[model samples]
Target: MASSMLNGAEGLKLTGMRSPHGLGSMNSTLHGKPLSKMGLTPFNLRKDAKFVAPKCSLSSSRPASQPRFIQHKKEAFWFYRFLSIVYDHVINPGHWTEDMRDEALKPADLYSPRLKVVDVGGGTGFTTLGIVKHVDPKNVTIIDQSPHQLAKARQKEPLKECTIMEGDAEDLPFPTDSFDRYISAGSIEYWPEPQRGIREAYRVLRQGGVACVIGPVYPTFWLSRFFADMWMLFPKEEEYIEWFKNAGFKDVQLKRIGPKWYRGVRRHGLIMGCSVTGVKRQPGDSPLQLGPKAEDVERPVNPFSFLLRFVLGSIAATYFVLVPIYMWIKDQITPKGMPI
Candidate 1:
């Protein structure tokens, strides 16, 4: 795909191919349901902060730079173990739909049956099923850390032809240049060092191969981070492009996928997704001419702000903590007079 094809929000303007999903028409209802149903709003109501250049500044205190909900290796293991039960039936459908997967796979041109593909962090094989739509299922491999999730994936008919393996995204078990296409979805947030994982994706793909990574976009508020960071990493648009380029991938472009379902109220922090695509270049090819270096958006440094965030996060956390207690109290108070 040419560089101009990824015109960001304008849409995938591929030449010679009049895609039913083309010309930024992926958002149109002709392709499927309304954007709201597919988990997209008409257009994001959030103000465009891209025009404002972020200032470079000195490092701040540890708490300021430190992300909330930082998970240790053990915490991640148990969290997914619990999540795997409800993941397929409850979680996967809300965000990553079949249409989103189609858009993510569009640039790869995977029509050839001979292409080898890998779905990194391919939990429950949701993404793997989508890959099989265009290419042979036997050509794909699904790698994830959770065996509980993998077991469910193995039971799916669409993924039966594919190979399943236990692996880490940052340190993949595959040899270098092993796959023609690399794709990951909804899993980047848990990566301890996401850039390292992106590098691994670049290392594993053959020259001119493409990788598509999908994840939640950064939420707008510190309070938002308190909720989201507990589960995933939400990198900004420029950060996604930067990670791909730094990993030596060419033609990096990012598209904001959706707000998903619509709400009547104009909410302060709307959730959006990002699909960042990049291609592996040939060994002797010239280095890609990258755009401006990514800038860090500065915020006011106040100890009181951190304290306030902690209190707010604590309150939210406490509310959930108190739910069972409240439920038990209600149960105790209510008289159970009828028994069969």
Candidate 2:
């Protein structure tokens, strides 16, 4: 029964693609309502909803020059346990505001209301909310490794119909050619293997589909670079484009983004600096080859070391939190049009 239902959904998707008006005008209704309202499932997992191991070996090598405390999956899982509580309120206002979110998502081309979209590492559904503004909530899926963050997303009234699941970004469970659009925002810095995650993004997207990844660019200022290195992976802009190109994406483009108060100053590097978009021209897995899983999740962690790293990483993170406030104050006092 599940298989038949799945087949039916695929038929709808294919039919929607042929329509002139896109998926929105397709006859995907059941009893005068969308199929999702009647529990018509969309996800077609590779291993019966279990983690599907990547085809290529995941390299454990660190992409950034220095090691970051929260780059590991286990550490990040714990970090968001506390941050999720005040994430939308505290982080959103300073770093990822509604305006910035909207502007960054523009290149992803969320044009069809019935387009199937996946928000990988969708923590707290902040970016997913931006997606739902253009597409139907039922057509969206939010996946993140952090249960605490997913809990916040589940509580959002606007996201009631969206499918929310706990999943890894580096090893997505979905089959290839699964989604029309893929988006990940402010989540790449936490990835231990960012290239693997970006590869997964390319794998899941259907031919002609778009993948938009929004993440922090490495800081140039000496002080900001110190804290950024300690806190998490702040990749240089060129790395983002290279990752997409290696994954077999075509026409890859990146748009620079930052807080309004920052006044175009990239010396310190905004928490969310660029939005990179790429089109999937093929119909299978990413072309980028990798080797062996980086960090072993099953490896036992020492209690003392974990405590020390977590504490120091939290302190480094505090510096970034205060940076926006400091810049905002400067922007207010530095005259109307001048940069802060």
Candidate 3:
């Protein structure tokens, strides 16, 4: 039989294979037999036997510069970092225009100069500028995480009076019940957790404070996939309602700010946008009803929208295609350079 020994000096177990004789030495044979006969495999235990570890490339172990998967806020932070330069001049003008901002702020009733307002994720001060138009700029606070975007906002002459701070929407750093009005626009699409951000809005708003959240509507499935590069979340109207109610908001109402069509079969603003407004009720007020109500959808009994689409389509085709063809035909028939 072979015996196993514990090499206390080296802190290693010397496992000896069973043989007809006794235990084998590390390099020598057991009794009169060789290591092979003793069924013992030789291990190179020499002090100078350098261990050659498997080659590990740093490239394989290192993390990537950009994230593998897109995170909403992180992607938006980087997106706006560069886009901030062209945001107000190029993007905001076409989409979230001054008219749209006015429409969003209509419900807030910012007429009172004493009303304190906070615009969460207010990048480039597009919405902030609108708020200050009604309320005093000194009473307004605009908070956003991207310094690049906020830097442009800070340079705005009107926004200079408003306080600008860097902060997150989901976890606002402000005190509870800090503002009388909360408004967020063109920013909710980038919220990683829309519900959490809304809750923060509620937390920072005082009793009877109005909170208005404006964002893009859920687009057609194909459109959603195409906009995947933008890393935006288009919430349906019901989602906005649910988010507000879940956050303990009262008097919650969903309003379709843009147009609708096809007897409400297709919403004109489905891809364009929508706004949800809710008021923080006083303690005694009743709880808000949870889902969207039937009246939320305004559907016309007649197929009037189809006619509207047809008329617009006809005008577009006539001006763009038919007009050019008619002009060419008229020139050919009239003869070259002849007024007659």
Which stretches in model 2 have alpha-carbon errors above 4 Å?
1-66
TM-score of each: 0.66, 0.81, 0.59
For 218-262, candidate 3 gives per-residue lDDT tens digits of: 433332223332334556544676687777775554433432111
- Cα miss at 72, model 1 (Å)? 3.5
Give me the candidate number with maximum TM-score. 2
- What ranges in model 3 sit over 4 Å off? 1-71, 224-230, 259-272, 283-340
Candidate 2, residue 176: Cα displacement in angstroms equals: 0.7
Which 10-residue span in candidate 3 carries the lowest summed lDDT? 1-10
Q: What is the lDDT of residue 70 in candidate 3?
A: 25
lDDT of 2 by residue, 1-340 (tens): 0111111123211110221112122134423754343222222222222212122111232355345998887888899999999999888888898878986887788998999999999999999999999999999999999999999999989999999999999899999999999999988998888888889999999998989999887775668877887889888655776688788887665556677777656566577877878888889988888887687788999988888888889898889888888888987889865644
User: Between candidates 2 and 3, which one is better according to lDDT?
Assistant: 2
Question: Largest lDDT belongs to which candidate?
Answer: 2
Error of 1 at 241 (Å): 0.8
Candidate 2 lDDT: 0.76
Q: After superposition, how far is residue 169 of candidate 3 from its true place, in Å?
A: 0.4
* lDDT, residue 34, model 1: 63
Using TM-score as the measure, name the better of candidate 1 and candidate 2. Answer: 2
- All models: lDDT? 0.58, 0.76, 0.56
